[model samples]
Each structure stands twice: as structure tokens, then as C-alpha cells.
Target: MTDNSTTTSSVDLNESRAPLLGAVAGLGAVLGVIAVALRFYTRVVIVGKVFHSDYCILAALVSVVAFTICNGIGIGYGFGRHGAAVTPEEITAQLKTTIGVIFFYHLSHLLIKSSILLQYIRICVLPVEKRICYVVLALVIAEGFTWIVVLFLTCIPFSAMWDPGLPGAKCIDNTAGFYACAATIISADVAILVIPPFLLRHSSIPWYQKLLLGMVLALGGAATIASIFRIRVIYMATKGTDPAWDAAPNGLLALIEVDLGLICSCVATLMPLFRRWHPGIWPRRLRHRGGNRLETVSDLNCVCSESKSTASEDRGGKTDVGDAVGSGTKLGPEQ
Candidate 1:
């Protein structure tokens, strides 16, 4: 009876958790789609198709699509698990797919950061400022790539990571891997968030424009918050050495955070164009007065005033001439 009760409780717990994870991942996927659509609309319509080396908005779009697919898969797997028991092989496949999804999740951020850095380069007119920005971009790219390498290859001999089902494979310290991932991700998120605001503040654009850009750029910080949330969830979820308990959620959350961040980064890149070109076809107010009529009326008034002034002066009275120059003065300068 005791064993049966324990089995029932375990099944119930898994059943409950699966749907919740599915819902979260599903909502993220939907939001990703909307963000991507907004990005493309801004790029093609507002910003124009002209390729500016500095403004590569397409990176964001690609990121959003990648995220959507990843989250969609998660949602499917999560809900599937809730509905029925999946084999260890199925679960392992799911875990491996998740790992791949998250790998691209971080990769997408690189594209976005590059797009934003390029935008900064686009509006920067000064040689010194441009050179400094380029240098900073180079450093950021190097760091991001380094971080990616560390993230993927941290355990060394990649087979060990997902080879738990295979008794023959040896893996590294799980705790060390977890902490390393958490630390590097947090550091990278902070680094990416830091560079943009500094770059934007000193950028050559007008102060108001820069402020607008800064607000848009701050969207990337939202991903940082997501990263922090994922870290917290992972810390809470994966306590035992079993590894699978913590690894699955951690991978999923990482995907969610980075995917959202990339989408936001792309959206921020398109913000300048959106500001310039409003999405709606807002109707302009029609004035009763035409441009030519306004000019014609002014011309007629000038001619009439000239004739009146000449006749008043011809009367040859100094008082009449003074009165004409004062109250009924000509609309235009005297010839």
C-alpha cells in the first residue's frame, strides 16, 4: 500500500508540473511571433529596404523565429508528458532537443547585439567616436563568442552531457557545470546590457532621440531579468545529483530568457524606424485654405494696399500720408 501511494503521488506531481511548464513556454512562443512580426513591419515599411551596414534588423527577426520554434517544441513536449507517460528514450530526446534549442537561444543574442552595435555605428558621424564604437563592438563580439564556447564545451567531451542513459559514458561535476553556466550567463547578460546605454548616451544623435533610443535599448534588460528568474528557478528545482530534474527546466528557462532578449533587442533596433514611420495610415488634417490661394490673397492684398497708399500720398497732405503709413499700413514693404 505504501509503495502504491508513493507511485501515485509521484505521478500526480509530474502531471501537475507538466501543464504549467507547457503554458509558460506556449505563451512565450506566442509573444515571440508578435515581436518578430513587429520587427519585420518596421524594417520593410518604416526603415526602408536600403541596406545600411550599421542597421541589420533581420538578426532580430531570425532570433524571434528560432525562439518561437524552440518554445513551441517545449510546449508540445510538456503537454505531451502531462497527457501520457513518455519512455526514457522520449524524455532523453526531449532533453537533447531542449539543449539544442537553448544553444541557439544564446547564439541569437549575439546576432541581436551585433545588430544594435551596427545601429550605433550607423548614426555615429565622428571618426573618433565611430572608431571607439567599432573597437567596443569587436571586444563584445569576442567576449560573446568566448562565452558561447564556454557554455557549450564546458563539460568537455560533449557526449557525456546527455549520455546518462548510456552507462558507459562519464560526465563532469554537475554542480560545477551548473554554477559555471549560471555565472557566465549572468555576467554575459549584464555585459550586453551595460554597453548599449553607455554607447547610446554618448552617441551623436540629438539628446531627445538618444533618450528614445535608450528607452528602446533598455528592452534588452528585460531579458536579464528573465535570466535572473531562470537562475532562481534552476537553483530551486535542481537540488539533487540526479541532474535530469534540474537540467530540463534550466534548459527551458534559458531558452525562454535568451529568446525573449533577442526578440527585444531586434525590436529595439527597429525602434528608430518605427518612430520615423508610424504603422497606421493616420489621416492628415485637411485645411480649407489651399497653398496657392493663400499666396494669391497675399499678392492681391499687397497690390490693393500699394494703390491705396499711392492715392493717399497723391492727395499731398502730410497728415493723410502719416495716417496711411500708420493705421492702414501696407501689408508688404514699400517699394
Candidate 2:
């Protein structure tokens, strides 16, 4: 009777949480799609010129969608159920799905970071700022590839990751590896978050616009916070015996982090759309009141243009009065 009672309690305690995972994944996928779609629309229609960053973001969105779909498949294979409640076959299937999930998750983040850095490189005029972005971009790319390689190499005879009893199979300490990856990601997130504020400080935009731009970029903090929470969840999941159940939060948080990153990256570019739909909505100071129209230059483009003009003036060159009136000149070749 005691044994039976314990089994009942175990089953009750480990009731499937797949519904929660499904809901979060579904919501994140939908939001990601919408955000990317709006970003493309803004760039292609409103701006009339798509950029390399736009293409990179679109690729990130595709990866995010694939990640969400893989999570859903894993859920169907008892991913959110306690290991004790899941059959061996179900666990194997979920493990197989997990490989894809991890791949797409990392791929999405890599593309997103690259997209943001490319945009920064495109708009930043200062040599120091551009150099910083390039350094960070290199780190992000290196970290992404390193994690991906480590993922595939986690288990020798990689199938042993799921079938741990396979003869002579070996696997690294994946929990420690995950921690290292998370740390790298957090570091990169901090760098991405800090770069914009530093650049903005040196920009020639009005103080109010700087504040607004800072606030928009500040949304990246949401993804950073999500990464921190994900690390916490990883630690918690490692402590639990029922990895299939405990790890659900890790997947959910991963989706949230990727989706948040993609959304935040796209929001600043959507400014042109907002202005087009509601021109008078901007503050009088932000909008052109006299012959000095702000035009429809993107926030980053405006900063780039003004920075170049400032640099030109600082060099004691004759500055065109029209340049200050939002001429919307292309800074250089699109990076």
C-alpha cells in the first residue's frame, strides 16, 4: 500500500506541464512572426530600401520559428512529463527533438546578434564605436560557433546522450558546459546593451531623442534578464531527477529570450512606420515645424547623418545649411 501510494503521489506531482510549454512557445512564435513581418514591411515599403541587417533578422525569425516547432514536437514526445512517467521510447524521441531545439535556439540568437551589430556598424560614424561593435560581433560569432560545436560533441556516439547505457559511450559534463555557454551569452548581452548607450552619448541627436532611443534600446534588457532567469532555471533543472519535467522551464525561457531579442532588435527600425501613420503624434520638438523637416530617416540613420555632419563641421569644413535640415543623405555603402 505504501508503494502504491508513493506511485500515486509521484504521478500527481509530475502531471504533464506540456500545456504550459505549448502556450508559451505558441505565443512566442506568433509574436516573433509579427515583429519580423512588421520590420520587413517598414523597411521594404516605408524606407524603400532593405538592408543586410533586415535580411539577417529575417533569417533569425526563421530559426526562431523552427526552434518553437521543435519544442512543440518534443512536447508531443512527453518532454514536459517527469522522467519516471515517461516511457523510454518517449524519452528517446524527445531527446532527438532536443538536438534540433538546441541547434535552432543558438542559430536564432546568433543571427539576431549579428543583425543588431550589422545595423550598428551601418549607422555608427565614430571609428571608436565601430571598432567596439566589430570586436563584439566577432566575440558573438565565435561564441555561437563554439557552443554549436560543443553541443554536437557533448556525447561521443552522440546517440548516447539519450541512450546513456550504450556500451563504451562517453559524454562531457553537459551541465557545466551549459553554464559556460550561458555565461558567454550573458556577457555578450551586456556588451550589446552597453554599446548603444555609449554611442548615443556621443551622438548629435537632441537630448530628448537620445533619451527616447536609449529607452527603445533598453528593451534588450528584457532578453538579458530572460537569460539570467534561464541560467537559474538551468541550475534548478539540474538539481531535479526528473529532467524532462524540470527542463521545460529552460525551453520556455529560451524561447522567451530569443523572441524578446528579435522583437527588440526590430522595434527601433519600425519608427519610420510609426511616423508615417501618425506624423503629428511626435512631439513638436521632434517633428519639423518650419522648413526643417526631419524626413523619414531611421533613428539610427538620423544619428549617423548628424554625426557625420558634426564631424565634418569639427574639421573646419563649410557645412551646408541644408544638411542640418534632414537631407536624408546616404552615409556610405550599405555595410
Candidate 3:
């Protein structure tokens, strides 16, 4: 007989899905759709018919959709229910769904990191910034492929991961391995985020504008935080036996993390669209304010030149404001 704890944790397969499982899965789908829509609008309408980053975002959207589909299927198979309540078939399906989820998780983030890096490379004019982006891109590509390979190879003969009763089937420590992958993914996330901020630091843009950009770029870190939560859930679920019941949160967190990454990837590129839509928004305001600062400097220079010119004319028409007296010289940024 199953223990009381098993009964308490497991859900009935015939019943509605667990709230956490359903809510997260549904929210992920909704957010992923919105993200992709915004991405399409930005790339098509504002960005002039797509770019490399747009392709990456589209690929990430596809992966997140696949991830969401897996979550939905798992939900029907007692994903959030207690292990004691799930049939053998339901649990098996859940395990299979798990393989798909892990694969898509790696795939989605791979696309996201690619999108972010591509966007950076497109805009970064400095050689140092381009070099930093290249290094980060290499890191992202290496880590993403590593995790993808690990997820697929974590089980030998593969089918053995979900079914321990198969002949000659063997599986590695899934929870620990996944945690390692998640941690490394988060590390990669930190690296990607750090690259942009460091590049922004060297930019001539105002410090406040850089700060805003940093915050926008850091949105990808939300995925990292979600991965942290997933790691904790994985650690706890590994110590337990309720696969159907315990794996729900892990599944939900996986969808959430991936979808959030996709959404944030689009968000980082949508500032132009946002500025066109909402002129008073922070991005536009930042640009406007920066322009005003430049205008102020130009005005001051003009005033200084006029004062010197008036004084020069007073002193026998001797002028020091060469080519800067009446012409409004737009000052170039200080190197």
C-alpha cells in the first residue's frame, strides 16, 4: 500500500490539473505568444523585415511552444498529482514528456542567447564591444550545445531514463545533472548580461541611460532566477518518490524559465517600437534629455563665441571665434 505522504502529494489523474501546474503552463503559453507577437511587430514593422536576431527569436518562440505543449501533455497525465494516484501509463508518459522538456529547454535558451548576442553585435560599434560580444557568443554556443548533448545522453540506451525496468537500461543522476546544467546556464546568463553592461560603460551615452539599458538587458536574468527555483525544486523532488506529483513544479518552472527568456529577448530589442508607440516612455525621454543636454552645450558655446566676438570687434575687429561665431556648430561627443 502507498504511504499517507504519497497519497497526500499525488493527484488523481481523472481530476483537474494542479493549480501550479496549470497556471504556470498556461501563463507560459500566453507570455510566449505575446513575446513572439511583439517580436514580429518589432522586426517587421520597426526593424525593417527581420534580421539575424529576429530569426533567433522566432526559433526560440518555436521551442517555447514545444515546451508549452509538453507541459500541457504532462498536465493531462497527472503531472501535478501525487505519485500514488497516477497509473503506470500516466507516469511513463510524464517521463517521456520530461525528455522533451529538457531538450526544448536547452534549445529555447540557445536561441535566446543567440538573439541577444546578435542584437548586441548589430548595435555595438566599438571594436572592444564587438570582441566582448564575440567571446560571449562563443561561450553561449559552447554551453548551450554542451547541455543539449548532456540532456540527451544522460541516459544510456536513452529509453532507460524514464523506465528503469528495461533490460540493460541505465541512467545517470538526473537531478544533479540537471542542476549542473541549470547552474551553468545561469552562469552563461550572467556572462551575457555582464557583457552588455560593460560595453555600455564604455559608451559615450549618459550614465543614467546606461543604467536603464543595463536594467533592460538584465531582464534575461529573470530566466536565471527561475532556473534557480527549478534547481531547488529538482533537489527536493530528487529526494522523494512522487514523480507525477513532484515533477509538476519542476515542469512549470522549466516552461516559465524558457518562456521568460524568450520574452526578455524580444523586450531587449523592442525599445524602438516602444519609442514609436509611446513617445514619453523612458527610452524616448532618455534620448530627448540627452539631446537637450547637447543643445545646452551648443547654446553655451554660441553665447561664449558671441561674447568673444563682441569684445573682439570692440578691439579693432580682432576675432578668435574662427568658423564658430555665427554657425551653430553641433559639438561632437568628447572622446
Q: TM-scores of all models?
A: 0.62, 0.83, 0.80
Sort every candidate by lDDT, greatest first.
2, 3, 1
Tens digit of lDDT per residue, candidate 3, span 1-335? Answer: 22222444344544444777778778877887887788677667654556777778788888888887877787777777776676889888988887887788788888888888877676553566678888888888888888888877877888887787888887788767867887888888888767656645543345665576667766766687888888777765565566666566677777778878887776766765665666545421112353652212212122223233333233431111111111112112111
lDDT of each: 0.49, 0.73, 0.65
Question: Which ten residues in a row are the worst by lDDT in model 2?
Answer: 318-327
Error of 2 at 96 (Å): 1.0
What is the per-residue lDDT of model 1 for residues 1-335, given as tens digits with 9 covering 90 to 100?
A: 11111232355435434455556566765666676666556556644443442234355555546755665565555523422354556555666565656566656666665665555454443465467657766765775577567656644456555565455565555456556666665665565566545644432223444355456655655677767777655543345333333344665566567657656755554543443465222111111234221112112113224244344333432111111111122223343
Q: Each prediction's Cα RMSD?
A: 15.8, 6.1, 9.3
Please, what's the RMSD in Å of model 2?
Answer: 6.1
Candidate 1 clashing pairs, residues 3+ apart or interchain: 54-118
Model 3 TM-score on a 0 to 1 scale: 0.80
Clashing pairs in 3: 9-82, 10-81, 10-82, 11-81, 11-82
lDDT of 3: 0.65
